[model samples]
Target: MGDSHTSHTGVRFELLGPLRALRDGVEIPLGPPKQRAVLAVLLLQEGRPMSYDGLVEAVWGGSPPVHVRNLVQKYVSGLRRALGDGPLLEWTGSGYRLSGAAVDDLRERRQLVDAALAARDAGELRRAAELVARAEELWRGEFAEGLAAPCLAAERLRWSEKRLSVLEARLAGQIEAGRPFESVHELVRLAAAHPLRERPVELLMLALCRAGRGTEALLAYEELRRRLAEALGTDPGPALRSLHARILRQDPALLAEPVPVG
Candidate 1:
């Protein structure tokens, strides 16, 4: 079913970090890990019904408690009590739905990402970088960190990759907006953190070349090439190889201002 709340829910939720519910800026005690997992699924559902079977699958995976329905009812009661006023979590005859929740960090991050894309499309590169940076600040830690459900683990992995993608976009925007020097150190850290990941290395190479450190850029490419060959018995892909060649030829195009990063 659709949402019940016609207006703001007053309860601000966070699933990007640990699952948290805040009412009037005060944190509510959401009980145990399993209990928090229930909230995680509900928040992700966004006012849609979470059927008992769906809840069992999401919260307990393949080995749910024998008393699943009764356990769910108890969990819901605790959640309702913690939420107190305004926000409502109710059984909808068919399933459970939460209403009156507002401004979840997950949605907040999406909003910022959307704004950044709009700014980028408008050619407001600096504004795009700033908006993406704000979105990056939304994560206190990994999304729904350590809750045991397989579905949530999949969500965590997806969010992790998305965070990396956004970081790449933000760094790329900085380079294209005439701020390559500022992107180098962070790109360096990003490359080191995910050695097998190629985009950060690609951006790192571009940033170094743009900052007039062409020699270092070539070395960065060589390092990635060596790492890839040794680990996967393969070479850097075509785009990265082409970039390496461009840097080597001192492709004056590389020095040209506002070259979009690969």
Candidate 2:
């Protein structure tokens, strides 16, 4: 089903996984790479639209063929066919726009997660978790994996990193809400998966410490320190350092009762 809003103009693309496009609960295949690339650029610039020239640059770098503009129009026609009669494209004086929703999947998810985190910080933890959970569910893998487009690479990394940060926020909220020692194992796995991310390491330490595994918490810190030095030639940053200081001082905050689950 479509969202609370009306119509199929509000299509969402889940490029993080296998480039799944959905219009009103129906899967819309975006066709071959060049075609998908055109649609991807359009979706990424929803509402604002892109000129034919701009899209040519996005899809074909600087040296598009003489027929490139017509090719782009054809691809847009194909996208419209797949996406239904919604206003997927609106011809502007200079360009075309993807009308409504103003979302690529990652952008939509970012908005959702950010809103949730804001709510959670304002003492609406349950609402926050719900939003973040929905956002995280949208990620299947790296964004647009097979595309070698230079512009999209930076965008992919930016979106992926934002998703990771929001996920960490959700986990931190879970820890605060007394989800249980089960989080410890997950934190450990996260630390292993992303050895360079100090937040997960610190979270793992906190989880162990709160579970009365202070020795293991310190050990976790040592392991992270070693890994950081060996892998990145650097130490944990200020946040991790502060966490270490808290552990050493045996700050009572470490022992404080978990926040009540909302």
Candidate 3:
């Protein structure tokens, strides 16, 4: 959790989708929701010690039970019993610390993304795309999903945005690598799914223009413009505006061979 260990064996903690713990590839049954919530908070901290008050604030938000500390201790104890009291989780004087032996899905996903970027920088386009695909596969669902605790829900949103960024990067890479037409269909779905995310729409417009469908590209911009006005009471930002302007001018630059993005 703190740093990359050479061995990704041992215990694995999955916080990307659901709160799950696996030892040697076998799922370990973590206790009830509260106990799993405690583990979720610890897992998010990534080896940093979480104090009692911090755990309560995260798990219970503004309305913790009367004997919250005792309940916390009880949950921790239950977790220990369920996990066989291994040194993976420990009390570090003031608070609980999860050891680095646990291979977290979040950390693994970041590593994959970094590798993908490295592959792109080296011009190994196929390898880079494969790495990105692998990274995308790591997410089974939302972060710490199906957990109702306030803290877990917050993490779910944070990771959701990050995953979207990863997907956007993949689309951008393919689009800039002279595969604009191929990118159009995927970008259409992505833009629709996240209507306010202008980046996907930007890519969609570029792809449309590259495919010699200038009119359709212009219509795409209009649709986004209207959607923004209808939803947020705002117009597209300068980036989208400038792209729209270029498409209107039938910018020759749009016809130029695409450059691969790093």
Candidate lDDT (C-alpha), each: 0.83, 0.73, 0.80
Query: Over the stretch 1-262, how does candidate 2's per-residue lDDT look in tens digits?
Result: 1243333455555666556676666677777777777766776785686887787777788777788878887888887787775655667878978776444565667688679968887988778888888877767688876765555666788877776777677777777866639678778888888878888887787777788888888888889899889998998888778878888888888767553322
Model 1 per-residue lDDT tens digits across residues 1-262:
0112123766677777787777667778998788888888887787888887888898889888789888898889988888888788998988889877653687777988999999998999889888999899888898898787877998999989999998898998898888889999999999999998889988998899988898999999999999999999999999899999888888887776564533
Which stretches of model 3 miss by more than 4 angstroms?
A: 1-9, 85-87, 257-262
lDDT score of residue 186 within candidate 2: 78
Model 2: runs farther than 4 Å from truth?
1-16, 62-73, 88-91, 100-111, 257-262
**How do the candidates rank by TM-score, highest first?**
1, 3, 2
Go through the candidates in order and give the clash count of each: 1, 0, 0
- Residue pairs with clashing backbones, model 1: 9-100
TM-score each candidate.
0.92, 0.81, 0.90
Give the residue spans of candidate 1 off by over 4 A. 1-7, 257-262
The TM-score of predicted model 3 comes to 0.90
Worst 10 residues of 2 by lDDT: 1-10
lDDT of 3 at 45: 82
Clashing pairs in 2: none
Residue 37's C-alpha lDDT in candidate 1?
Answer: 84
Task: Estimate candidate 1's RMSD in Å.
Answer: 3.8
lDDT of 3 by residue, 1-262 (tens): 3223222445667776787777766678988888899888887786789888888999999899999989988988888787774536788889888765454676778898999999888877678777888888877777887787888888778878888888888877776667788888998999999988788888888888888888998898999999999999999999789889988998798678454342
- Which lDDT value does model 2 have at 123? 84
